[model samples]
Target: MTDFQTAARAATVAMRDVFPATPLLRNAHLSDRFDADIWLKREDLSPVRSYKLRGAFNAMRKRPEVPLYVCASAGNHAQGVAFMCRHFGVNGVIFMPVTTPQQKIQKTRMFGGDAVEIRLTGDYFDDTLRAAQTYCAETKGYFLSPFDDEDVIEGQASVAVEIEEQLGRLPDHIIIPVGGGGLSAGAISYFGNGTQYSFVEPLGGACLRAALKAGRPVKLDKVNTFADGAAVGQIGARTFARLRDVGLANALTIPEDRLCTTMLDMLNVEGIVLEPAGALAVDALKDLGQSIRGRTVVCVTSGGNFDFERLPEVKERAQRFSGVKKYFILRLPQRPGALKDFLGLLGPEDDIARFEYLKKSARNFGSVLIGIETTDAANFATFFAKLDTNGFTYQDITDDEVLAQFLI
Candidate 1:
C-alpha cells in the first residue's frame, strides 16, 4: 500500500477502538427519487456527530508526547477535540467564537469534562484561530488544525478505507461536501481516479473551486455562514495541494437557501436529520440529473449537528428556494379600503407570513413590507396578476437582502 493508504488503514484500526465505523448504508429513498442507486457514508453518526473526530483522534494518537493540545472551532471540530481530549486524558484548550450557539458550547463541555478548557474568544473564526495559535505557542501546546494539517488529512482518509471495506469495492461516483477540503483531499487520495468524484460546496463557501481556479488557496472577501459547519472563507493550503488539480467542471456549488430544501426533505421524508452542510451532496444530485442515473453513487452525509431552534429558519429558506414564499414591498394608497381590497385578492393557499408597515415613502402612499407563503409556487403568479389588475404598485423584495434583513 502507498504511504497515505497505509496511514489511513492504521487510523481506521485505531478508530475502531474508540467507536465503530460510521455506516455505509444504501439510501432507498434517494435511490427511487434519482433513479440511481444511492449510498450514504454516514459520518454524521460519528461520536462527535461529524468526521472531525477521526482527524482529532489520529493526530492526537500519533503524538503521545504532546500532553497539551489546542484548537479553535465553534462547532464540530471543537466537540471532536474535546471528546478526544477526554479519551486520551490530555489537557486541551479550545477557543470558540463568543457568538457560538449555547447548545454547541454545552455539548463540547460535556464531551471534554475536565480534560478541556473552553475559551470564548473572537467574534469570528479567523480571530479565534489566531488567538488559539498564539496561546498554544506560548504554552507549548500542540495546536490541532481543523483541516490544514497533513496528519489530519491522513486521518480523514480513513473514511474512504471504511467505504471500501464496507462496500467491498469502489463506488462509481462519490459526492463529497467541501469546506476547507480536508475530507475531499483525503477521500480523493484513497479512492484516486478509480472512482468519480463530485465535490459539492455551499455557493457561498466554494473555496475549493476558487483554489482550483487560482492554482492556490485564496481567501474569499465574504463568506455566508448559514451552513457554519462548511462555511470556510478559504481552502487550507495542505488541502489545496491535494485538491488543486480537480477540474472546475467536477465541482458543484449549492446555493445556501437551496440547501434548506434538501435538509427539510431529508428530515420530513426520510426522518434523517441533516445540517445544511450535511445536505449539500444530496442537494447536488438534483443538479447532476440523469447524468448519474443507474450508477452506484455514494453521497457523504457529512454532519448532523443541527440545532432544532433553527428549524424555522430552515423552513423559511426551503420555502424561498421552492418559490412558494416571497416578500414584497407594496406602495399602498391612502384610501381606507385599499388594504381590505388587497387582502381579498389572495388565493386560499396563500398565507401572509409577515406584514409590517414601514415609514411613509410618499405623500399619498405608504410602504408596506409583506411576506407571503403559499402551498404552490404558482400561487405567486396568480397573486401578482391580481396585484397588477388592481393597480397596486409593488416590488418583490424577497431577494432584496438589505430590505429582507430588516423586515423578514
Candidate 2:
C-alpha cells in the first residue's frame, strides 16, 4: 500500500478511541429511486456530527509534543477541534467570528469543556482567521488548519479507509461534497485511479470548480452562506494540490435553492436531517442519472449540525426551486371587485400564501404583491394562463433576485 493509504489506515485505527467509524448504510429510498446501489457514508452520524473530527483528531495527535493548538472556524471545524482537545486533554484555543450563531458557539464550548478556550473576534471569518493566527504566533502555539495541513488530509482519508473496509470492496463511484477540498482530496489521493469520483460544490461557493478552471485557487467574489458547511471562498492550497487535476467534467455545482429540495426530501422521506452541505452529494444523484444506474455508488453525507430555526427558510427555498411556490406583483384595477376577480384565477390546487396592496388607495390601478403555493409545478402554468385569459397584468418576481429580496 502507498504511504498515504498506510497513514490513513493508522489514523482510522486511532479514531476508535474517540468515536466509532461512522455508518456506511445502504439508502434504500435513494437506491430504489436511482435504480442503483446507493450507500451513504454517514459522516453526519459522527460524534461531532461531521467528519471534521477525523481531520482535527489526526492532526492534533501527530503534534503530541506541542503544548497548545489553535484554529479558526465558524462551524464544524471548531467543534471538531474542541472535541479533540478534550479527548487528548490538550489546551486548545478556538477562534470564531463574532457573528457565528449562538448554538454553534455553545456546542464548541460544550465539546471542549475546560480543555479549550473560545475566543470570539472579528465580524467575518477572514478577520477571525487573522486574529487566531496572530494569537498562535504570539503564544508559540501550533496552528492546526481545518483542511490545508498534510496531517489533516491524511486524517480525512480515514473516511475512505472506513468506506472500503465497511463495503468489503471499492464502490464504482464516490460522490464527495467539496468545501476547502480536504475530504474529496484525501479520498481521491487514497483511491488514486482505482475509483471514479464526482466532486460537488455549492453553486454560490464553488471554490473547487473555480480553482480547477483557473489552474490555481482564486477567491470568489461572493459566497452564499446558506450552506455554511461548504461556503468556502477559496480551496485550500494543500488540498487543491491533490485535487487540481480532477478536471471540470467530473465537478458539479449544485444550485443553492435546488439543494434545499434534497435536504427536505431526506428529512421528510428518509427521516434524515442534513445540512445544506451534507445534502450536496445526494443532490448530485439527480444530475448523475444514467451514469450511475445499476452501479454501486457511495455519497458522503458530510454533516448534520443544522439549526431548526432555518427550517422556514429552507422550506421557502425548496418550494421556490421546485416551482411549487412563486411571488408576483400584479396591477389590479382599484375597484371593489378587483381582488375577487384576481382570486377567481387561482386553480383548485393553488393557495394564496400572501396578498397585500402596495398602496392602500390608488387613482386607477393598485400594485398587489402576492405569493402563491401549489401542489404541482404544472399548476402554475394553468394559473398563469387563467390570469392571461382574464387580462390581468402581472410580473413574476419569484426568480427576480433583487426584486424578491426587496419586495418579498
Return the top candidate by lDDT: 2
Q: How do the residues 64-96 of candidate 2 rate in per-residue lDDT, one tens digit apiece?
A: 898899999999999999999999999999999
TM-score of each: 0.98, 0.98
lDDT of each: 0.92, 0.94
Model 1 C-alpha lDDT per residue in residues 1-408, reported as the tens digit of each score: 688888899889988989999999999999999999999999998888899999999999999999999999999899999999999999999999999999999999999999999999989889999999999999999999999999899999999999999999999999999988889999999988899999999999888888888888999989999998899999999998888778998999999999999999999998999988999989999999898899999999999999999999999988998999999989999888989999999999999988888966567888998999999999899999999998999999888889778788
User: Which pairs clash in the backbone of model 2?
Assistant: none
Lowest summed lDDT window (length 10), candidate 2: 338-347
Question: How many pairs of residues collide in each model?
Answer: 0, 0
Residue 43's lDDT in candidate 1: 90
Off by over 4 Å in 2: none
TM-score of 1: 0.98
